[model samples]
Target: MTGSVWLVGAGPGDPELLTLKARRLLDEADVVVHDRLGCASVVQELPPTTRLIDVGKSPHHHPVPQDEINQILVRGARAGHRVVRLKGGDPFVLGRGGEELRSCREAGVACEVVPGVSSAISAPASAGIPVTHRGLSTGFLVLSGHEEVDVDQLAATAFTIVILMGMYRLPTLAPALVAAGKDPLTPCAVIQEAWSDRQREVRAPLSQIAVESARAGLANPAVIVIGDVAEGV
Candidate 1:
């Protein structure tokens, strides 16, 4: 009688933003494996009897590799424990929830995904920037800034571009967008620690966003919004 695994999204750092289903799963899970960006309040609210496994990873630092995380989930389920893989933001949106699900299925473990609000939209909205508006933007693109994405190609799109985990890459990304024909004066905003008490935002033109962000001493765990929507126009 193998147990099941639940891949739960912790939303954008706000405990209250957690979905009812996610909260219920957290309380009922026998073991919770969480990431670094998970809501602190929710983690603290876990029942004392629930086991916790911290697999948090920082940029360029993976203390618990993804493979190990998958193995941990498989083992927990095999032991007949209700396991929850809690991730920041929507698990499916650049959180690698799909990979974890595949791992579970391969191991014959039943898995479920409880989606939560993604920072791609929630982060920008917290700063009063809608990802899309009637005339500002008809649609938006959500991308991970953790890799070598093609800013040039992305610049050609009319949709608002929301970049997650891109604070560190802004230096190159901002310039690339400008060089790729995006208006140098296009508005951009960087929201840090979205939905948290220490949340802050920095707005600038696409060409100067990297400089402004540097001047503000912005750190990781931030989202970057590029295009007209960032100006809240």
Candidate 2:
């Protein structure tokens, strides 16, 4: 008798941010597999009898590979245990929830998704900035600031650009944006460890973003926003 899997989003880093459905799933889950960002807080809500598996993936490090994670969910479900696959922020928002969902479907594991507030919007809000304002920003774009980022295609898009997991690629991005004819003085901001009390925000223009970020010593799990919307904060 195969059990089911719940693909739950733990929401940013706050346990209180979890949905009621997610909370219920956590309490009922016999086995929980979680990411590094929201795992610590989620575990605090679980009963001691529940089993916990740490599959946290941090920048420059992957504690558990994706294949292993897929297998864990399938194996646990096949063992007739209610499995919970937890993630930070929105599971589908760069969290690879899509991949996990594909694997589960292929293995015939029943699955469900519980949405959570993504750090993409919440992170900027923590700094008092709005991704979209009445007049400041008509819309915003979210992109990965990684080396593989398509600077040309991204620049062509008119929405305010937000980059995730791109701290290490800031140097390349800054220059690319400028070369694409974007205003060198366009307002930019980077928020580190967003949504946490220790969150740090650094604001600068496109030309100075890389330099400013380096000087501020911003690290991974940070979010970058490029547009006039930042000034509206």
Candidate 3:
């Protein structure tokens, strides 16, 4: 009797944000693999006999490699233990979930994906900022803050830009947007801990966003929005 793997999104930092399906899976999982970003509290809902594994990523902190996680999932499923592979935000959105799904497929393990609220949109909404408005913004562009991506293209092409894990790259962002022909005074805002009671919002323009973020001490699990869509709030 081979077991199955469930890739569950734990939602942006709030345990209460978990989907009903995710909650049901946690309650029944025989083995649970989770990341640091997702609320660990969800494990509390699991049966005491359930096995828990943490595979979190940090700037310099020690963390389990991805391949190891894949192996763990394969091993547990082969052992006939129902496995729940949990992650932060939506599993398909930059969560490296595709890799895990491929691993399960190759290893002959049945797997399913459960969607969760993404911080990309939730974080912005938490700050009372909308990514789109009737005429302010038609849509939004989502980007990774850690990659060495071309900020110019993002600034020029994206009406409302949402940057995940981008606080560290703020110093170079403004100049890049200016070079991309985006207004230096374009309204922007950064929201932290979306859907959580501790959430905070900082509003500024491209010209001063970096400076304001520094002053406000805004950090990770945060989202940055650029354009007039963020200003109407």
Clashing pairs counted in every model: 0, 1, 0
Off by over 4 Å in 3: 60-62
Measured against the true structure, the TM-scores of the candidates, in listed sequence, are 0.97, 0.94, 0.94
List candidate 1 stretches off by more than 4 Å. none
Report the C-alpha lDDT of model 1 over 82-144, residue by residue, as the tens digit: 999999999999999999999999999999999989999899989999899998789999888
Give per-residue lDDT, candidate 2, residue 16. Answer: 79
RMSD of 1: 1.0
State each model's CA lDDT, in order: 0.91, 0.86, 0.84
Better of 1 and 2 by lDDT: 1
Where does the lowest 10-residue lDDT sum fall in candidate 2? 142-151
Rank candidates by TM-score, best first.
1, 2, 3
Per lDDT, the best of the predicted structures is: 1
Per-residue lDDT of model 3, residues 1-233, tens digit only: 89999999988877788899998998899999988775566676678898999888865564788899999999999999999999888898878899999999999999999998888877887777888888788888888887887766776775788888888887798778888888898998888767777777888888999899889888876888888877756
Highest TM-score model number: 1
RMSD in Å for all candidates: 1.0, 1.5, 1.6
**Model 3: lDDT of residue 12:** 88
lDDT of 2 by residue, 151-221 (tens): 77776766788888889888888899789888888888999988677789899998999999999899887
